[model samples]
Target: MKDFIFESTPKIVFGAGSIAYLVRELNILKKKSAFFICDPVIEKTIFFNDLSGKLKKEGFIVNIFSEIVPDPDFDSCDMARDAIVAAGSDIVIGIGGGSAMDIAKVAAITAKNRKKAKDLVKNPELCEPGMPLVLIPTTAGTGSEVTHIGIFSDNDEKLKTGIVSPYLYADVAILDPEITVSMPETVTAHSGTDAIIHALEALTSKLATPFTDLLAEEALGILYRNILPAFEDGNNIEARSNMLYGSMLAGKAFANSSVAAIHAFAYPIGAEFHIPHGLANSIMLIPVLKFNLNSDIEKYCRAARAIGVQTTGLSEAEILNRLLFKLEFLLDRLKIKRSLGYYGVTESDIPRLALSVMKVTRLLSNNPGEVLLEDAERLYREAM
Candidate 1:
């Protein structure tokens, strides 16, 4: 086994009714004021209103910044940090999907350190732990709640960059299945696909450790079995709970082991085209899997089995082929039609996207196989 180190800070509280514990957790942390970061859609939800009301009733002054946009940018982080400082909040709570959580994580650091988001992006280690932070995930994907990496788009560059440091990990993570019950069917499918991809990529990453492998395997299994049921019936509390738990495990695994080429390629698509991160990941999944297959056949086969593919009687090549087919089928079943062309991506756009992929060497270095510029261009073409 290769040498490896593991560390995480989030104390996870998980269950169907775990949102009720937010007040208790804040009290334990002695937090008197809160700055909530969330998407505008979530801000209008009854669930969010009720939760905000309860926190106010408990004597915790709450200020909400609900301008969080998808594929959040550095400017948004700066805005959120300004809000946190202006509110004089003692705690920062992120209460939605990856975008909300990511902004909150970086804003917390920026608020306390009094630094620019761009400066911190250039040197993630400069980010000091800031304010009491609580992350409540309303989506079962991204695993942003337990991760130490916060991703955002760089508008000037038209690509995504991540601030990766232990300081970004949440102090507490509350996973309440009831909150996810309101997800639209498309959100459920895309988010679930993202979680599964996290496990798969982590398992195949060059930094994969025994500890991460164990978590990734179980996460894959749970996600494979429950994603469809959850997508089909949004109100299935049991399925929703399992998906959330599995996503958190996947997040933990990837946080330690790291994700690789798929994420590297997905970043540009999301940043440039406004594609949802989960959907961008799904579009690139099979192409990148094929690229990495030759690097570690055994690991890929194990991943196939982990996702519930039967490999008992198949050769390595057959198993890999079957696994690819199964993934394609899953995407179709989940109503994720495969084709970049469907999303308005053209052959002329491949070069720019490939160049963008090259810039994400942070993620590319974790890939088990070498991904050259030509390989990236080919992957984009294949995705199309």
Candidate 2:
């Protein structure tokens, strides 16, 4: 095994009612004034308002940056930074789904550095040490609350890009399942599957080490056991708590080991089609797994077993085939749509999508198997 270094700095508070720590945590982080960033959907919800009000009561000047949009683009980050800077905010708080939290991280970094949002997204090296941030996630997917990567789109050029830096990590990540209980069943299903993909890819990463694989295995089992219950009955606190905890574990696992093929392919689908990130991931998981089966069949078998698919008395190839069937069963049971065609993608767009995938070599390079241009194109075709 290769040598590895693992370092996670964020302080995590997770449970059914962890958001209650917001005020106390912010004070400990020395945040005198906070810019609470969120999407309009969440901003309008009672959860957001209640949190905002409570923060104000705690003597923090609370400014709401509620203009965040889906798959948050450069423009949204720019708007958020402007709001934070104008408010003279001393701290950043993210209180919604992944997009909102991701954007909030970038916004805090940009505001502290006094640089344009475009500069940070376009030139990640320009990042200066940032102000403190507290991430209170209202969703279970993405784990932007803890991860060091932020994805955004450039609307003018219609391209998706990423900014990766340890400096962007939140000082604290608050995961409260009560906040996630309101997620629609479809959102629950998609995000839950996305978390599963995170663990699966981490387990098979070329850089995988004992520590990350162990985390991924535990997370995969937790997700498999609880995701469906959370989806079918939105108010299942136990299921919600498990899914939330599972996603955090998967985030940490993948953050260290890296997610490979599925994410590399899913980025284009999300950038071009505007599909939600988790749903895009769900649509691509099985096809990417099939592509990856030949690279590490034993590892695949282990992953299959982690999700409770028995492969005893079966050959490696047989286990893989059974794993794909099991994945299909999960997708069908969750009612995830299977085709990019439904998202305005056509066969003619395959060439463009293929080219876009080439840009995500950062992720593609980490897969156990080589992903040639032709190989990526075939995966996209199969997914379609």
Candidate 3:
């Protein structure tokens, strides 16, 4: 077993009606004033209005920053930070998809540290603990609620960057499946695929340890079994609950063991094309899996088994082939049929995308196999 250290910081409250405990959690954290961050669309939801009303009734002064957009940029983080500071927020509560949570996490840090998102990305160590954070993920993806990473786009460079530090972990995470039951089928498929990729990448990462492997395996199993059901029947509370828990488990696994080439390569595609993060990852998942197939055959086989692929009396090569077929079938089943060309990416774009991916050494270095510039270009071409 490789030497490893596992530390989980978030106090997780999970189940149906888990949001009901929000007031108790806020009280326990002594939150008098909160800077609530979420996507603008969420502000129109009855759930959002009800939650805000409840908080206000509890005497918690709430200032909402609902300007978060998809693939949030540095400017968005700055805007959120300014809101947090100007509101005199004692705590920050982020509710929505990954973008909302990511912006809130970074804003919480930058608001206190008086640094811009770009500055923090360049020097994550400069981050001091910010205001208390409570993250509620309404989508079953990104796992940003449990992780110490905040990803954002650089609009100038058309690339993605992240701030990775322990200070970014939420002080509390509320996982309530009721909130996710209203997601569209496409959202469920994309988000579920993202969580699946997170588990698989963490399992095969060079940094994977015994603990992470166990968590990733269980998470993969849960996601594989429940993602389709969740997508087909969004109102199925059981499947939604499992997918949410799977995403959280995957987040905890990757937060410690880290993700590798799939995430590294997905960033450039998402940044340049304005594709959703989960969809970008879904498009690239199979190609990257093929790229790393030989790097750690045993782990791949174990992953196949975890996802319920029968490997009894099968050769390693057969297991891999079956796993690849299974992944393709799952993609088709989920209707994630987008290719690089579907997003208007061409062979000419591969070089730029490859170079951009190489810049994310933080993620690439964790790949089990050496991913050369040539390998990156080939992977992009294959994904196309």
Candidate 4:
């Protein structure tokens, strides 16, 4: 056991129809005007139109910013900040996947704190608290709503960068599985896989404490059992709801304990290849887990059992072997691309990508296993 402190969003409203709770949270914050941020696709959806309509009907001034792209850039984030300023938004309501929520987080903070998105990336310690933010997830993964860490693409540096500060925490997070019911099959698989990896990495992070392990352990059970069900039947509300809850639990766990080298390895490939974050993490998970297993056999074995693997009477090696096979089977079932080679990454590119992983000390430092430059190169090679 170690001394630790846990922090999460102040308020979390969860369940099937919990999107309706947003207005009440807004009332508590006493914010009459909201800047609603989402991707252009979401803005065009019936769900977005209806939700925003409800806000307007309640006499709340609503402004829409729909310019967010996948793997959001700071330029887009800066534009969002300006949009909030122009709209005179009292709160920022982010309603979509990770990218949209990340932009909304930036817009909220910069709109009030007089800081640019890039400044937060560079000097997160200097970040000041911003306007109240309410996050609504239309996807069952990412866990962005409950996390203080925000990731964005730095196109100038050609890598993904993270900003970590308590100031980035949302005031309210609405986990409404009903909103995720309409998610496309591929999106469901990708997002759920990301949450699964979040739990897995957090379990073995050096900063992991007993409190975080409890949440991550339960999260693994819920996520592993429900991800396939949600993917196979998007209309299954029970499965969807459990998946959302699992994602949030994992978010809270990782928010305190932090994620390890899997994320560090994922970031470089995601930025370079334009792969979505979840999918990139999915690709890297098995390889990094294989590398980390020997570093903490007991915890890794517990992780296997947490995900429903029956490991009674099994040796540690056998437990790890079973976990790997189960992960591979799940990836196959979801049609996840398991090879970096499939995405056109080659042995020649390994050096450059591994170099980028070394720069993510924010995540790598927390890995249970010590990851060096050579280890990074080898892991990427294994993924290929």
Candidate 2 C-alpha lDDT tens digits along 1-384: 768987564599888777888888877877788888987888888877787788777778988888877887877887888888899989888878888888888888988888776787567777877878888877777767778888887665455677788887889998999989999998899889989999999899997889999989998989988888998899999999999999999989988899988998888888878988888898888878888899998888988898888877988888888889878988898999989888888999988888888888788889988988898888889988
Name the runs in model 3 displaced over 4 angstroms. Answer: none
Model 1 agreement with the true structure over 1-384: per-residue lDDT tens digits? 778889775498989889999999998899899899998999999989999999898888999999987888899999999999999999999999999999999899999999988988778776667777999999999899999899989999999998887888899999999999999999999999999999999998988999999999999999999999999999999999999999999999999998999999999998988889999999999999999999999899999899778888889999999889888889999999768888889999999999989999898999989999999999999999
Q: Compared with the true structure, what per-residue lDDT tens digits does model 3 show for residues 1-384? A: 678888675599999999989899989998889899997888899998999999899898989999988888999999999988988989999999999999999999999998988888788887778879999999998898999988898888788888888889899999999999989999999999999999999899989999999999999999999999999899999999999999999999999999988898999999998888889998888888888999999999999999998898999999999889988899899998768898889889999999999998999999988999999999899989
How many residue pairs clash in model 2? 0
lDDT of each: 0.92, 0.85, 0.91, 0.90
Candidate 3 similarity to native, TM-score: 0.98
In terms of lDDT, the poorest run of 10 residues in model 3 is 1-10
Comparing candidate 1 with candidate 2, which one achieves the higher lDDT? 1
* Residue pair clashes in candidate 1: none
Which has the greatest lDDT?
Answer: 1
Segments in model 4 whose C-alpha atoms lie over 4 Å from true places: none
C-alpha lDDT (0 to 100) for residue 27 of candidate 1: 88
In the order shown, the candidates' Cα RMSDs to the true structure are 1.0, 1.5, 1.0, 1.1
lDDT of 2: 0.85
Give the lDDT of residue 177 in candidate 3.
96
